[model samples]
Target chain A: MTGHPQSSMPGQKISIQASQLGKTYEHPAGSVVALRDLSFQVHAGEFFCVLGPSGCGKSTLLHLLSGLESPSTGAVTIKPTSVGMVFQEHALFPWMTLERNLSFILDQQAPAQQAANRQLARRWLQKVGLEKFQHAYPHQVSGGMRQRAAVARSFAVQPALLLMDEPFVHLDYQTRMQLQQMLLTLWQEVGCSVVFVTHDIEEAVLLADRLMIMSRHPGTAKTVLQNDLPRPRHLLDLKTNARFIDLVEQSIGVIRDELQAVD
Target chain B: MRMKDFAIRTLAPLGAFLLWELCSRSGLLDARFFPPPSIILYHLIMISPGEGIFRDIGASLSRIVLGYSAGCGAGIATGMVMGLSRRTRDLLYPLVAMLYPIPKIAVLPLIMLIFGIGEMSKIMVVFIGSFFLVLINTLHGVVGIARIHHQVARVYRISRRAYLRHVVLPGAAPAIFAGLKLAIGYSLVIVVAAEFSGADAGIGYLIWQSWETFSLKSMYAGLFVIALLGALFAYALEWLERRLIPWRDDRDTREHHDA
Candidate 1:
């Protein structure tokens, strides 16, 4: 399916582009293809979500875009931009405190602005409601809070592009909702392009400016749905809204069809 | 609960001491060889000034400290090389494997021949014992760190110095510290063995001298000090480990269980 370039911020410039991307991992037995012929572009300030079933190579796609993994077939071209990424495991330095975790990124991103980075680190921690926990190590905090810190860290760098590979997948439902809202609020403030990968249809519907539905294993972009849900979406309100449920069901229908086709 | 723990902790050792005293006093064991704790204490006080027990302790301690530091420094540097580079690991692993298991004291005669029967030979024995233990542990620690950290370092574009300082060091700290603790015990064993084989003034020399002269009480006193040193070193390292890696203790209970 082709992306319609549906965006919340109209006339925003292109932030990332990838064409005919593919990734293959070779084991002792043989080579396994993870992704193939996947093409997508992310607009500036756009919240682009990739939705797929597990093992669909949604993560491989994100890794390729973020330059964490190289595609054997094609290339990903970022628009001379800095990219920040959040992994599914939160991946905060276990040895460092929450403040240092954020400052580690900030200090590297803006070494010349040391004092400013320290202040920004504290402010970012506060934004995630973790100012009190700035001195606490990553292991000292709950799994949910660590992921919050991870989000804060990605946003703290002020990258033009952010790649999130199932950041909320390991979190429980309650923490997941809280983090999603926190992410949306932070994303609004930063206004960077985000390529969020998730298998959950409801999350894709809620967060995506344009959602790419991916087919199972050796994933290809099968459908691209433009989310027409109104802005400033809250989880509680969106659950009750008819249009929100319709969008969710429509995305679910696409995934359901893919599952049946696999059978 | 606290009272129960205290009671068990104190009573167990105290009870053992009382039983030992009773056995020795009642002539159940040879008093000459297994003197009562009080006699050992008395000999400890008598030898404190005349025989210079403190000087012997100082001598042994200096050897251990110097040897341990040198071994640790070399071990960490070599282990880093082996852990970070495949070529170094390939070159060093076989050599290390061949040398590591050979009892360090077996080479004491050789070390004495080369370095002479002075402090150098004793120190070298301790150094070899600690070096191999710490190097193997440090290598394992460095190699065992999760790949997630390497990816994180690349993604964030952390400087090489900062990556080693922050991520690599701390990630491998627990393992390295474990190695250090084990190395300390090994150091003590080798130093004592080296001294017993040949030395003028050390705890090991003192113990051997007392035994040769048939001063059983002083021998027991020396034994007491050696036991006390082992406990003290273990406690000291445990304290340092807690301070350095405080988060390890606070880590999730489930994760601790898994480990």
Candidate 2:
């Protein structure tokens, strides 16, 4: 499926571009293809998500975008700015406290600005409602709290792009909803392009400006979905909104069709 | 820890000592081999002012301290090299596996033969004992760190220095500390065994001399000193671990301890 330049901010400057991307892993027995001929572009400040069934290579796609894994074919190009990422696991440095976790990113700043980074870390922690736990180690906080810190850590770096692989999948339903809203709020504030990958149709509908539906293993894009859901979407309200419901039904239909085809 | 917890911690040792004292006094157990706690205490007090015990302890301490630090420093460096590279680990694994299993004491003769029957020999035995344990544990520690962490470092473009100081070291800390504590425990055993045949002034030699003359009190004194040192060292290590690895989640008790 081809993706036309979807609506983003007025300028719509490109943040990341992935063209004909593919990845294959070689084991002792044989090489297994994870993704193939995948192509997508994320506009600056766009909240994009990849939705797929299990074993659909969504993670491999995100990893390739993040440059964590190299694709056997094609390439991903990002704007000249530091990239930020979040994972299913909170991924906070276990030894550092919430404050330091954020500051560790901002430490890339000039030595003169370093003192400000510590204060900036505390401010970011405050934005996540974790100011009280700023000094607490990741292990010392709740799983939800740690994820909040992880989100804070990512956004604190002020990246031009953010890549997340099912960042809230490990969280409970309630915490997941809370984090999703908090993530949206942070995105609005940071104005960075995001590529969030998840298997959950409702999650993609809730968060994505444009959703890429991926086919089963060795994943290729099945379709590019335009989410018409309005901004500041609270889960409770989104559950009842007509547009949100329509987006969900459409996403489920696309994925259901892909899964049936796999069988 | 509360007073109750402290009391509970000390209960077993105190109870055992009391029971031993009672058994010796009542003649249920022979007093010759298993002297009462009071007799050992009395002998320890009498020997406190003497230079012999101090000199012996100093000799053993110097050897252990020198050897253990050297071994652990080298072990950590080697472990990092092996852990970071598959090639290095593959090259070194068989060599380590071959040397690690032979009891460190069993090779004391070989060490003494190479280094000579001097302080170097005693220290080498301790070094050999601690080095392999630290190396293996450190390698495992580095390997055990989740790959996601390394990815995070790369994604964020963390500096090489920051990556090592913050992510790599801290991630591997608990395992490294475990290795260190284990090495200390092994060092005590290896040192004593090394001194058994060597010409010298060490706690092990003191124990050997007392054994030959049938100086039961002095022999017990030597044993008591080693035991005391072991207990102190263990407690010190635990305290240090708590300080260094305060973030360590006692996995089993995480739920219970969560605020």
**Chain B, candidate 1: TM?**
0.93
> How well is each residue in B1-259 modelled by candidate 1, as lDDT tens digits?
9999779878976898889999999999888778889888887987655888888888899999999989988988788779888899999899999999999999999999999999999888888888998899999989988988888888889999888888888988998999899999888888877888678888898889988999888788888888889978998998899999977874668465433
User: How well does candidate 2 match the true structure in TM-score terms?
Assistant: 0.95
Off by over 4 Å in 1: A2-12, A261-263, B1-11, B252-259
C-alpha DockQ for predicted model 1: 0.50
Give, for candidate 1 chain A, the lowest lDDT window spanning 10 residues: A1-10
Predicted candidate 2 versus true structure: per-residue lDDT over B1-259, tens digit per residue: 6999999989998999899999999999899988898897788769633738888889999999999999998888888889878999999999999999999888888887899999998898888888999999999999999988998888888888888888888888888888999999899988887888875788898889888988777788888889988888889989999888888757447756644
Candidate 2, chain A: TM-score?
0.93
True contacts kept of each: 0.50, 0.70
Model 2 lDDT on a 0 to 1 scale: 0.85
Go through the candidates in order and give each one's DockQ. Answer: 0.50, 0.67
Model 2 pairs whose backbones collide: none
Give the per-residue Cα lDDT of candidate 1 at B200: 84
